[model samples]
Target: MMSISPHQVISAFDEVPTVGHCLVACITITSVLYGLYQWLLPNPVPGIAFNLEATKSLFGDAPGMIKEVSVTGEFRVWCAKQVKKMDSPICQVFIRPFSKPWILLADFRESKDVLMRRKEFDKSSFLSDGMECMGSFHGIYPTGDKFKWNRQLIQDLMTTSFLNNHVGPAVYSKGLDVMKLFEMKMNLAKGRPFSVKKDFEYASLDVMIEFAFGKNWVHTATGPQVELLSKLGASEVKFDALDQPVSFPIAPIMDFLESVYEAPEIVEKTINAIMPKLQTWWWSKQSWYKKIFDEKERIMKEQVAIAVNNYRSGHVKTGIEHMLMREGARAEKEGREPDFGSEVFRDEMFGDIVGGHHTTSGAMMWLAKYLTDWPQIQSKLRLVLYETLSTAKEENRLFTFEEIRRAKLPYLDAVIEEMLRINAVTVTREALCDTTILGCPIKKGTQIFFVSNGPGFLSPSIPTDDSKRSETSRAAKLNDKWDETHDLTLFDPERWLVRKNNGEGLLEDDVDFDGAAGPQLAFGLGPRACWGRRLAHMETKTLIAMLVWNFRLLETPPALSSHAGFEGIARVPQQCYLRLSKI
Candidate 1:
């Protein structure tokens, strides 16, 4: 039904009218029906409704709100501002009549209820079917049982235990590489402003190579002198020393991953989703893509070959090794032959790697900015690190994964939480069946967005249900409850620290994951939440600690301050600049 074009629908409607009088009568009836729909159809969760035609119109047609949403992660910040003013915790937003009405929820409890309960909400096919992406594309678009099997297979690699051994040292080593590179760049610039954007991007990709492969693959630039598989989309990797070079075919593999992540829009998605074979046939004809896919296949073969060799040898700790072993286990369990060397296996391993690598690295940009804008918090953080990691500092060594995890640094914890809150994406889910949230009916097929950043993250305190209290006093109470000492919008980690024992610090446990959107949700909620979250936190925490202990982020560079970042699936800060003398 969806595959049928609008022109065909219009033509069918024209055929409904037999003659001139009949055509006039049919037009009147259609107009009346549309008017009735406008009048009825439950008032969409009320706030400042969008004037799509006036603001979004080109020559004059609603270009849709998704263009903005798809292009920038910052749109959620704007959404955060709008939904906060609505009367209820959940609001409804419709971009166009053809599109599903977006159920926007500010209440974290409701978000959890929907996200956690798979019976009620399954991940909408928008990312896959809506985008016309082929198949459930492994680490890309998730669907059905294949997703479950793949997720289960890769689950161990992303776990806190596995990553603690694998990721911590790799991230620390890469983080140091970045620090040294930045120090050199600062020295060369003298007093001029220098950017840390390249450092973040390259360090992230570099870290991934070690984390994913576990064995030597490609060793590109570590400082300013070398090119990071330059033909690949990555910016540049700088070299601190001229040394070892690891050879690996990196470009085609990374190119495919990049292309998959950045899928086409609604129209193309619809056509491609409905007619995948034809779509595939057409896409394969493109010479550029043919080369890309061929290269991708070659890279996958190389990866498998290396992973198999590593397994045969004693060096079997890599993510690829974990995946390959799991595939073997599954074959024994299911009474079928082991299936390796397939696209499915490739997607699961590479997809998880890319997801963990890019998102985790992207998060550093936001954390850096927050630290730069709030130097006092940075100072306090350094104190905590020095006290907690004093042994490591004196020993001239990196803190172990356990030490980083178990350290009594609530301020650092709070700072990390606060950064995640202000910059996290509001997750979306589609109703698999008819569901009701907080008494509001969510029809089956409805697409809902859990606005985690609004009341849950930034608000700090949500409204108390007391109909007797006036809105003004309630507003005052919210201000008093959530933000008594500072502007909630500013980068303030102090807000997360509350009195515990004799000192102030983060709540006793992972407070962010609270159903109400305190610190818990940047990764997501429930069983289906991000498997890589713990590893992400550990890696970022290690990097942040290393950077803070070594240097102070003095002031935000003008370019950085205005940086809205790469407004996409993840809102990555494009640049982070600081003028510093090594401590």
Candidate 2:
């Protein structure tokens, strides 16, 4: 009700500073209010469980995670631990500051539902962002026309005929080289426990390189080891202690094999960045990155030229040749020339090499540890191999690809399944649109982490009723629950094997491996599952049969045999040592 005169207002305005000062003051106030609002705001999704402190800060869970990662050097396991910390099957964490919180779902039924039913979910932007460091045409891109095209291009490589005829034989032949390398190492170490992790990794890389480029492309990683050890005697290899790991001459960074191994590590680092695509751009500008990138490009160009020449000569033995053929077919269908040097072709081949090597190596590394720890299981597997491959055993020869593939070794299959389940890899997906999971609403573009090493997998599942799941999920339910009689945390292969009545009624104790008896997301699920699963199974089974048949994996010292593992693109054992004796 009080009226102010113009003179009084002028006097008050004169007390204030310049316009710039007033503007600065306004900005400061606005910023403070915005900060407060962000800090006080609740999680973006209502009714979903999250860390309480995250909702009270602008950065959310990122600071805590950065701290944890700095100390532990692990990201995937820490993500899984959040589910246990919250004591809920579904929980959210804000990893990317200012972006939407990531939902961590540990329940297999719901996670499977989301992955299997692709309408509500698709490959995460996180994947495409990570793969951006590689190229836009990499197969990990989100579900779309691009993904379909990339998949179709390499579809022939994964076919049953190609796998059995081409991949199986190549894997078996390379695995023999690995087994021989281990034998030479065992001799040099003089019964000492030594690291075989690199050997396994390199051997896998060799197989992948061959798989990608065909037998004519000579770039085996284990070739250097074979060359080195074939010349050196036991005393010539200089090592101090009998208990220590033997060191082989290091391969240079520019070496094609080593470069292939190191490139994926950079991709892993890039994806872990706050802004993955931006990080990739920054990395691309750096000299070190450029050097590797250039070297890989050079090699790929050479390989592509060789593959083209080979195809012209009617040589169709390699994956690249088959891909070129597929491209020709597609081009004919579309009424266009096949682009042999296309980014899509190059990216797919490189992506396959990177993806195939890391995952298979990780699995093989874990297999060595498990075999060393449980000799009984090892012995049982050996017995089965010997029984199933009796002709090879009687002839005292290595098992053939056909022999191993045709053999119905239930126990061996169980071991592989159990290992995959226990050490299942982490997978990511993004919501395609606004959707609900386990009765909780999920916003579009929300990144969801489906943990394979968490509840309903490595531990007892958090109880939930079927009524809470989506009607589609409930109707599509096919998997049975894990047998509650056994401890979930234990690594027992028998969990996958169940006695079944033979239709002929001749064998009452016949057992079959039931993959659906329990939860497993090792290869993920549905349309976007691991593309190389069949190849992985074939390679793993053959390698295991060969290794167990060739040598008795002796137990290692506790210090050398620690089960502690560090998670990267794959969860690899901190220590993978083998003490072997010839069978």
Candidate 3:
């Protein structure tokens, strides 16, 4: 409006170009930032950076067999003579090619910190993936609000009360079933070279399936269900090795093979076809046939249906049933939709069976091998078990939880602990968040791993430096060599047992056998700790007690060489040929 000079007009035109250039620059910066974000935040993969190479280097390379490597930087320790050479409780190692870094923590104190802080860390994606892979039948994978809801339901079910009331009986009955299988095998073998491992696997599978699904899948005679169960078990064992890190695109291929060989497209197609029928049977409001059909549903509808039926019938007699009923009721009360139907429930039940059964069996195998190799310790265990069972009806009779508790077998406990420490059955966990561990800054999405095969023997008898009379005496007496591999070879149960100077009696000092304050890292630490620890402990203890109580285990003539075998996802004990005989 005001009279503009020629300079003012030119200035206005110049401002227009300036504004356009500023906008272009802003757009360019934003584009670059977006690209950078994409590069930094890649999609999650199960066991993404697990250090397979390190595991091979440490455990001796079993090419094609070892799948995933733990991200724990433990290779140095593995090669070293001791378990605590690293300054921190956990040590970090970065692998090449993928830049996969792992934290290897064997220090008990640091492990405790990680184990106790559940909210800060969670079960790694690797664990979740395995669970999901097994839980697919029930849609347990693809965790959502529903999966959360279902997990809540399951938590209630796995409580001690439920375990005592229902699951205990089922487990006991299943134990009997397993015993029968062992007996049958014993009879058939008649001192022949029979594979007890294979027999134990089948028996455990049968027991778990029966308990979860309310039906038996294993048979002396082969059929579809039997064949499928066998295939699934074998496949699970194979997948355990492959559950490691590598550049190879093997997951899809493994999945495809597992699908084709084990359960197959036909199995899924059959399941899909039967799903509608199963739903009809499950949802029928007015049918008395619900009970009859529910029992039958174990085969068709899977374990969830069996559990639901048990719940509806007011039979909270098993762990699975208890979990299902509690979950269902809680969901109703909270006005949340039920996440687990019959199919999902079945998947979870089967998951427990598959996940738990072999581990216990494997422990038993090791117990047999160790006890056989160390007869003196076996005698000690037998004496303790016999004395504990003195008031019981018979030696071979199924032992109760109380009896197991009272036995207080230190050597037996130590042997089991040693096996768990030396021969790990599970893989290391992945870190979920950017967290500082033992004063080291761990970025978010780091894969944390651990190994049990170390030379550190967690013993209560070992004298602490503080307890010695003089600093020199402490240093001389408590030599660093005690922490070395040679000392670890002294896997004597008495190392856990405190003794008097007289060597004639036991010390009155309380033994913290659980390693609550000691250097042990078997079950892992933090919020994502093993959910089934109690069950696992009980199973291991029971199997050990039973085997040691009756049978005398002998190490094979050649000392039965055992290696940790890999089948992609699982790290398991390689087949050990052992010698066994009736006590």
- Top candidate when judged by lDDT against the true structure: 2
Every candidate's lDDT: 0.60, 0.82, 0.47
Which is better, 2 or 3, measured by lDDT?
2
Off by over 4 Å in 3: 1-100, 118-120, 129-132, 135-148, 177-193, 214-300, 336-344, 393-410, 425-433, 455-486, 498-514, 559-571
Per-candidate count of clashing residue pairs (backbone under 3 Å)? 14, 0, 29
| Segments in model 1 whose C-alpha atoms lie over 4 Å from true places | 1-73, 81-86, 130-144, 221-294, 312-315, 395-406, 460-486, 501-519, 563-565
lDDT, candidate 1, 75-151, per-residue tens: 57656755765545666655434444566777654465556644677665543443332332453344467777877
Order the candidate numbers by TM-score, best to worst.
2, 1, 3
Per-candidate TM-score against the hidden true structure: 0.75, 0.92, 0.62
Candidate 2 ranges beyond 4 A from true positions: 1-31, 34-44, 239-242, 251-254, 501-509
Residue-level lDDT tens digits of model 2 in 265-342: 887887788898888888889998887767777788788888888887888878888888888889999999889988
* Model 3 root-mean-square deviation: 13.0
Considering summed lDDT, which 10 consecutive residues are worst modelled in model 1? Answer: 239-248
lDDT of 3 by residue, 1-583 (tens): 6799999999898777577799999999999987765444322223222333443332222221212223322232242212243323345443321333555544333344455643455555433433333443322232346556556646755567755544455555555554544443333333432335544444444444444544323332112222333333322322212212111111122221122122321222222221333443343443443433343334435445656677788876554665677677877988997655645565555455555555555666666666766788778777767755666636546577556644566556666776665555333555666765544666776656554444233322222224412222233322231234335544455544443355433222233244331345555554444456666665667666766665666544442434444222223345544444566
**Best model number under TM-score:** 2
